[model samples]
Target: MKTKYQITTFLIALTLLFNSLQLKATNTIIEPDSDKDKLIIYILRNILTRSHYVVKDINDDFSEYVYNEFINGLDPNKRYFTQDDLKEFSKYKYKIDDQLLNEDISFYNLVYSRFQSKIKNAKSYYGGLLAQSFNFRKNENIDVDYEKMPFAKNENELIDYWRKQLKLSTLARIQSKTEKQNAALEKDPKTKVKSFKELEKESRLEVLKSMDELYYRIEELENDDWFSTFLNSVVGAFDPHSTYMPANIKERFDQDMSGKLEGIGARLVQKGVFTHVYELVSGGPAWKQGELEPEDIILEVAQGNEEPLDIVGMRLDDAIKFIKGKKGTEVRLTVKKKLDGSTKVISIIRDVVELEETFVKSSIVEKDGKKFGVIDLPKFYISFDDENYRDSAKDMEQEIERLKGEGVTGLIIDLRNNGGGSLKTAIEISGLFIDKGPIVQVKYRDQDPIIKEDVDPKVQWDGSVVLLVNEFSASASEIFAAAMQDYGRAVVMGGNQTYGKGTVQSVLPINQFTKFDEDLGAIKMTIQKFYRINGGTTQIEGVYSDIAMPNKYSYMKFGERDLEGALPWDKVKRANYNQTNSYQNFADVISNSKKRIAENKKFNLINEYAKWLKENQDDTVFSLNYKSFAEEKSNQEKEVEKFDTVFDYTSNLTFTSPTYELPSLKEDPVLADKRVAWHKSLSQDIYISEALNVLSELKMNNTYNAIVKH
Candidate 1:
């Protein structure tokens, strides 16, 4: 199933499956004698260029590894693709030669053209959606249930629906031109004489510039991964931590591993091809400037301190390259600020952000005379620094030591929002609690099995452990949780199920050595799949907890099986793990927790709030004239304001002085009221309160045998 998770791919259209590559500049050509030989030579050149990375030489090891990984996700019973096709792919295995790909523009154009036709079919819908989603991704008006869309079931309807999607998106762009002209008029007072029609025309032209956005998306992955990343990126951006990375994104995974990242400690996105800063990282260079912020339009990049170069139509990769640099370098950015509506140049210095700060601060949860240490592992931490290698093993070790000193009785490792990373580190970290043994097994297609075992014979904290995960916990997170659950060492608790990704990915660099060909570089194909020690697979069917909790996310449907081309569930030979005799009874502990939570007034109120939140998760469209829309929006806004005051206390603290007539967090105007309010809500974190109750239950149960188990 792990193999299946990484390998599920669906070709959108029959034409796309076998379409000929397109071209942009076809001014020159050679004598056409050996077209076939030329193509073969081109393939070889492309392969060798990228074939220089780890596990190069295209040896049997690389070939076999690629074969197993890719095949594990394949459907063998169906002969949709023949062995001959497999052989053809083998010849170009682990390679995409530069020479072969020098100017393969035709391929891109073909894909783009086919995709763009859909946009033309429905103009207004595409334009409208684009206008709304672009300006405010938070704008729920553009939301659509893909399963409910007409195109989801019938191919003919699907094409037309997408055409409308494009139209609405494009229309949205047209609305922005008015903003530009209004600005021009404000500045010069001479560029006037513009009516609403004229303004609309200007916006349409500017918006037309982004028509290629969706086209580029379809051409890039051909729907194979377009939908896969849709959920993770689209929704994940709502909260800084949530996101989805399908098994198909090896290149992105490799980028994260490379220690070089983009976005200037911020997030960039395209709601409708108009790229903008989604959010600024706290304490980031951009954040320090107090200039760049969420929803700021990135108009241009100026290298060094030079004149800004326009980048409106640039590729996302190119935009990213322009932003990232050595840790100490500086980059000046020209941004069209959304708030106060101004344009400004902000220069920022690059810096590394510690991932730990993004996570919850560690604290000891005491209940009924027992102590339980709780730590939220947001994502896998395996930084590529030389001395400060941020492996989960080392970090958890330090945390364990600290928690031990705090004199905690049990441990609750929260894996929520931890999408996954560094499988190697996950195994090593899991090994910390359990003695040396097989933690997880990975089986591939027609190949010998490879089992990843924690070599450490030493155990760190063998006390009662509880792992909290949600639908977002995936890959390495799943690996650790599954091993602990399979061994009956820890109780897995969270929402419906964890993200069912159980495959391991190895990033292969396509053009690592070339200084000239900057445009090249595709990350590796998936290399292998990971399985748990038990018989069941963690592929599409993620790990279900011993006890499920109510989550605010309800519109969120269950199971990856709902996804088209999603890899089906399968099983391989299971490995063995011995359950520790010292393991505490989790059922009893859970029962106590349930009783406590049911009686807790705060938790009950939170449950009611969570139920209210579920009904509002889906984005819905609204008209400017709808009274109900205004009322609903107004009511929600009021509720948020009230909750905002409540949220302030739980997550923040206020410091008021003798001169203060009102409470405030800081003297600064921007940080005064809201910050003060946020501090107030810090005490009202209902979910955290529930977790505290569980910790208390574990404490009373394990106090006698509280010391770390060895």
Candidate 2:
């Protein structure tokens, strides 16, 4: 006897499975060999050298960089290799360039083989150490800062290093388990808590289990993955953004950009050895079937009539590859329910999973009797393959019109953590605030700068505009912010500076240049650089905010300036453009905001938190002794507790959806809940409260000027 949910799911899955078999497969597989490898290297080098913004001669220096970079990428912790291994590999320090030109991959093979051999030895080293009991009372510490440390001097020294690492990990786990046990005892007075010795033994066993799983997964790595890393190292020497994508990874990237995937439409994350359901996509196959829910642990996955494959202990990526298939395909998942832990096989038909969260959305915020809009644009998303696809520019325009219908007096475009996307969308979106102007200037290698202009004369919202940004706001985000600042269209506010990614990359497929059946993944090469309308390039020096705000990430190095081989900041001739002069008291308002921030207690707390975070980041080396370690953690926790009020600050504001979205509350409860949660977050955001104050000041100044003119 099957439940209604199970019957519905199976019927859908069976119907889709038949349809999937009838459709023609588009992808063809090719084996990696010397001929294909030579073609890839040849095509990549030729394209990059000719089209890259900054072309470098493949000489001895470049070869040395590639050698060090590849080695460091594989074993960044100074593990897996000894001093003797480094010495032997030093011979190829300046020969990699010549070998690449000759289509030679012998160097990669040599290094990869050595890494595999060393990793095998390391497995035995950790196994032997974990077998014995660790002394937590030992007065010893391991310097976990691998960047400053050298490679192992000998095999004996390497084994000792592994021993300390394993011991430190095991000790941390033991302390964590003991604390949980103590908490459980406190909660239930009659319950008997496990002793510290018993907890320690259990923690050690758990750590050993996790390590065994990790080592097994490492051993299962196919040659294609390793070769992809090596090829990435070769192209990465040119720039950080330039790289090679394996065929499978390329397919996923394409799906991500399009915001669609053919799968059961459930977000999964690995916890320990099991894959748990995080969220089900709205209106997706699994969501419609309705049996799958959040926190359900998936034990096995089967395709069509195949035997279910146990996914426990399998890597997340590998398991996902098995679960996701072409649309109309049938997949069955053996899921263990979260509440009762009862297992059931739920069949689901694969459909296109549309990621709705990636799109632009707006909320009407009312503060101090004045309604304003906050447009949270996550990315400048657009699909190049689909010309009719919905993009950020179009979505933003629609949101603005909807907010206008709700009678919003001001607007705030929040681009925090928005690592940008489509360049065309950024240009079009910038034009919405101002009448018309040049948005950005692009310069290719030895070519004239191409000025991208928004020639439209229609100004959607010229009143009280504010742009919010943070360190993660990059590329197209920087372009939009910089355009607004240069034109004096909006008051840009947030962290010290945005992420400075001004270079443009074009993904060129290698198969297009060769006759090979292999779908050799594309080379995403940086082809051009972009500059602000005012002539400054946001290459390494990103756009600065008009009103600077302090946060926990203020002291961290996350911008393009922190990346190696990043392009330098340079200025070109300024484009002919007129400023909007939107704000009448821009200078005075900025000064007043600065004064208010200086006096604000919450801002002061943020500054203190930033300093504390920096200090803790710098102090990486930790005491291995349990007592000292406990004391250090306790003191840190006490210090953080002092700033508890920082998160407690909430504004006396209300947020609501527009009239058009109101009916959806009754139609779709899930969407209604999401909107409710989003609204609640906005009402509590301290930064947004301050932004409203800024908008009020702008509006008041405009009114004052109008009275004086009359």
Candidate 3:
């Protein structure tokens, strides 16, 4: 009787009814104050599950993923949560998906409350540990890779772990101070060097101060920060790239995208208990005021006619908020100059500051009787609000034209450290090199792939080209490199692979779909995956360099594939496009370059340095004994001295801008100085020199082929 179709249908209905009841029972009611966040959660779920490229169900499997990822992200070092805490949390590991579907945040509340308690306890542990003077003679070592260790069994174990970490940090600081004081005394006989005991006391005081500041900052975390982390964990469960941006974080992103800021215009970093000036914007309020300088430690910040607040022990972001005021508002800063420990109060009015250094710049490098152009594009930046904004493609085209007028024989597009932007711009930039064809193919869920092409037949430069990239070059940068490599338009050179980001993200503002009075931030979701015209996706495998050079980061494992929960690599049908036969003997050319690099002294040095770096990084266990730590550091320094000659190599090349840029360079001293520095570095770069040689080889090879044809 149960085998009948009617019996099967009844069983299915019973299971569904049970799940429905469970969903209702698990539903949580958010507080009235958090109604807006609850609404945002609802909207985000719909967007991610419905509009995202990959649709997934909020079930037990998904709940387990969110729970594990959230906990791991919070306690990356396993220093906070104990074994008992994790055991308790494991109960809701598979139940979180139900809670999320029902808009219940009881799990988040419970975890976050426990997290706060742990942090408070951690603060006490650090305080007690630092209150005791560390023994430098102790023969002990600490594990830097704390992730490999298990969670503490109890409070006693956690306290012991904290003590070891604190001891390690204290030893490092003491070693650094000892070396600095010894060098100072050696340089000047009149300068008095403190005794070892005195130096130890100073190091302890500095470490304690830093720990206090760090804990103070942690204690200041509001509900918004914790909520953002929780929401991000949910979004991140989908993919590494997709995430929710809270209102405050989104505001900073908007400013960075616009390349404009209203502030004192000085970059600051927390050094011990003080916020030290890293750099001053060339044309910003701080530089114009002419009082603030790099390495100056800011002590206090004051608003107009208001009492100054001590910023020495304050968090960097909080200190910055105090220093940054609206346009035309006067903010005062109490600073201490590093060169001479003299305190000075500088007052300045904030104004709109636009960063000019983040733009297209080109320098003409004359090498081996041939002139070549190098265009360094820091980022593929464009303004969505401003239609007439000068984007990477438009500016790059102009830089090429200028370089062409300078009679350069070849071009190099240096996209090193360029974290990509603007997919449209990447396609347009790729088109500038080729005559006209499909640039990249974008595939959305359950839809035919969309082919983006350049209908314009005009080729920007029809000559030997080389594109330079590094591990950090990603997204749009990979797109351009892949297109060029596919079409043989440029010789891709640099690290082994480009950053393998081959996904497209679209920002969805939460308030757009609803009439919410409160500001609900945006969520950037991956909507499509992109592929090269040749059909291969650059997801995890990234575009491989045609000529791989030995790099300092050769040992570092930073790639898309290295990221957790990253999408896998796949291929689609290749777009119909013509492969340019520009370089007929490309393989022979690469082989020859490899041979040359093998014999080059600088390349060998680089290879050795990379190996040494890997060994050093893999060594996670560091000695806490002052003598052993000092000896290890000293050996590292000596090894570094061997590679000093790596930068000593120089090319007999002259660098200059085109005639059109000279007039502007003359007027802007800052711009001229930057150009000079760029040229100086280029001259010292062995990689660029080799790239120039490759261009020369290509030109010679072309000439030989032409003679044979004749």
Best by lDDT: 2
Tens digits of per-residue lDDT, candidate 2, 1-710, equal 00011112313432353233223112222223446676677667766666677878999999998898788767766668889999999889899999988778778878999988987887788788788788878888888767777889998988878877777767776766667677888899887877767777776776676677666876887666677777888888889878787776555555543343338877676543468885565446786677887668897788987856767656667888888998889999988765333456799999776567667888887767788998889778886558898988999998999889889888999998677878889999998877777999988787788999998867777568889998878899999999999988788999999989889776655555555677888777776789999999989889999999987678866678988888889999999998766677888888888899899989999888877767765666777888887787678779879877765677778888878878878999877877887788788888888888897777434643343233
The collision pairs in model 3 are none
CA-RMSD of model 3: 9.8
Candidate 2 minimal-lDDT segment of 10 residues: 1-10
- C-alpha root-mean-square deviation, each candidate: 13.2, 10.8, 9.8
lDDT value, residue 264 of candidate 1: 64
**lDDT score at residue 68, model 2, on the 0-100 scale:** 83
CA lDDT scores, all candidates in order? 0.51, 0.77, 0.76
* Native-to-model Cα distance after best TM-score fit, residue 64 in candidate 1, in Å: 28
Candidate 2 clash pair list = none
